[model samples]
Target: MKFLIVEDEESLRKSIAQYLAAAGNICDWASNYDQAYQKISIYSYDCILLDLTLPDGDGILLLKYLKKLNKNDGVLVISARNSLNQKIEGLSLGADDYLIKPFHLSELYARIMAIVRRRNYNGNNVVKYNELEIDTSNKEVKVNERLVYLTKKEFDLLLYFVSNKNKVISKSAAVEHIWGDDADMADSLDFIYTHIKNVRKKLTEAGCKEYFHSVYGVGYKFTDR
Candidate 1:
């Protein structure tokens, strides 16, 4: 999963990113509203951990912006404010969930998984496409009941592909999704091709039908048909 942590506190932001990364997920962060705005404008995430307060602007406005752009990115508002009106307003603005500050990282992760599952898999933990069965909760993939082991990156790539099946995913988008926005500093995006190739090879070897199709001059597509 890919997530953006829009937080101001350096310690809390790093803590969230580290916890999510340890669970095999990609995470990017912004210390203020402007930085967060820039990232959201350029890249989309499976979930956005939003902080209501920022140095430059109110985080609530960001929610309004996402609504204006009609982006369906799941948002979880994490704030110290416990007011009922604030929670109500955040949800009304399109946040999928809300968590109070100083909460357990485990609980935060669970909420993120729940929101992603609801948004991408229609609230299901298991994803099925032809002979492929992915247990998102367990991070397991199976081809016709035979387990297919995958590295964390490989698993994330497969999930991203399946989530947006049949869409043309540009190399830049794939890089941002799999490696986070920090990958923009990398020398090249050629590494993306190698990862995709490896994923295809592994799935095919596991008896799963080929579902990945490379789009010339664009990127790749995963389709059941």
Candidate 2:
């Protein structure tokens, strides 16, 4: 998953980003309202960790923008505000969930996963196709009841392909999804082919059917037919 951390406190922001990154999620950070605005306006994220107060303005304004565009990206508001009205307004404005400050990072992880599952997968923590299964909660993939050990990138890759099955995913998009802001610094999309090749080989070796197909000029598609 790709997450955008909208926070003003440098230490906390880095801490949160680091924790999520360690958990195998790509993360991007924005320190103030304008920075956050620019990121949300341009990039897509699986979730956003929004702080209610910022150096420039209230974070609710960001929520308002998301509502104006009718964006369904999961939002887990991280705020120090304990007022009832504040929490109420955040949720009413489209935040999927709210976490008070000084909370555990583990709890935040759980909440983010819950919201992602609810919004993106209809509350499904497990996703499967035929004998291939993904336990999102554990970040594990299985084929024919046998465990498939995949590197973090490979696991993320498999989830991306499974989620968008039957659709052609461009290499650039896939790169951005996996690497987040670092994708901009990348010289080329060639590295993606290597990862795809590895994933293809692993699944094939695990007794899975060929579901990933390469599109000559565009990118690749994962489909059953």
Candidate 3:
């Protein structure tokens, strides 16, 4: 998973990012409203860990921007303010969940996962598309009840595709989602082709129907038809 930590506190942001990264997620962060806005406007993320208070603007403004753009990115507000009115406003503005400050990193991770699952997989740990099934919790894929073994990267890629089924997943989007910060150091996007080829071959060999389609001049689209 790829996440954006929109937080102001350096210690808390680093703590969250470090924990999530160790758990196989690509984590990036923003220390204030402007930085967060810049990242969100250009890139996509599976989830956003938002802080209600920022240096320049209210976090709710960012939430409204996301809504105005019709973006489906999941958001979990982590703020020092825990008043009923603040909670209600955040939730009403489209936050998936709220976490009070000075909480354990483990619980925060769990909340992020819940938001991701609910946002992408309809709140289920398992995802299904006809004969194809994915046990997200275990990172397992099966076709017609037969197991399909995939590398960590392959599994993540497949999960990404399934989660955003039938959508045009741009090359940039795929690279960012999978590589996160490492994407900047990489020279080119040619590696994306290699991964896609490998995923297609593995799924086909496993007797799964082909669902990936190349969109010329755009990106790849995963669809049943």
Candidate 4:
């Protein structure tokens, strides 16, 4: 899963990012509220680890702004404050969970998985679409009981398609979601076509029916034939 870690503490932020990366998660760091705001406005994350105290502004205010924007991004508030009021307030402001400072990295990982499961898969560890199954915990994909090999980007792209099945996804949206804001430097979306082509080829070779459809002038959609 993709995550954004918002914390002013350099050591803590790096620690969280490294630990989560080791566990097969893509993590981005934001040192302060402004950075966090910029990241949030530009990209969509599976989950966000928010530090209540930042160099520029209160994390609670950011939480409020996220809610105001109607962004349903899952959030976990990681703060030094352990007061009942703070916890209650954070939850009320739309945080999915809270983690106090000085906590174990393992616990943080568990909390993130829990929140992601609840938010994306309805607390299920696996995401299934027709004959295909995605083991989120193991980052494995299977089609018709046979394991399908996939690169990280391919897996992420497939998951995104599955999650938004039947919806048209523009090339720009696919690039931004899979490659982030840096995709603007690319000369064209030919690379995106390449990725989609490979993903479709792999799935087809695995004896699966075509579920990914190119929308010609528009984009692509995942739909069962």
Tens-place lDDT per residue, model 3, 129-180, is: 9888999888899999899989888888988998888899988888888888
The runs of at least 3 residues in candidate 2 whose Cα sits more than 4 Å from the true structure, single-residue gaps closed, are none
lDDT per residue for candidate 4 within 3-25, as digits (tens), equals 89999999999999999888866
Q: Report residue 122 deviation for candidate 1 (angstroms).
A: 1.4
Worst ten in a row by lDDT for model 1 = 175-184
Models sorted by lDDT, best on top: 1, 2, 3, 4
Give the candidate number with the greatest lDDT: 1
Q: List clash counts for every candidate, in order.
A: 0, 0, 0, 0
Clashes of 1: 0
Please list the C-alpha lDDT of all candidates, in the order they appear.
0.93, 0.91, 0.90, 0.89
Model 1 scores a C-alpha lDDT of 0.93
Identify the runs in model 1 with alpha carbons over 4 angstroms from their true place. none
Clashes of 4: 0
Q: Which residue pairs does candidate 4 place in steric collision?
A: none
- The TM-score measured for candidate 1 stands at 0.96
lDDT of 1 by residue, 44-144 (tens): 99999999999999999999999998987999999999989999999999999999988999999999999998999999999999899999989999999
Estimate TM-scores for all models.
0.96, 0.92, 0.94, 0.93
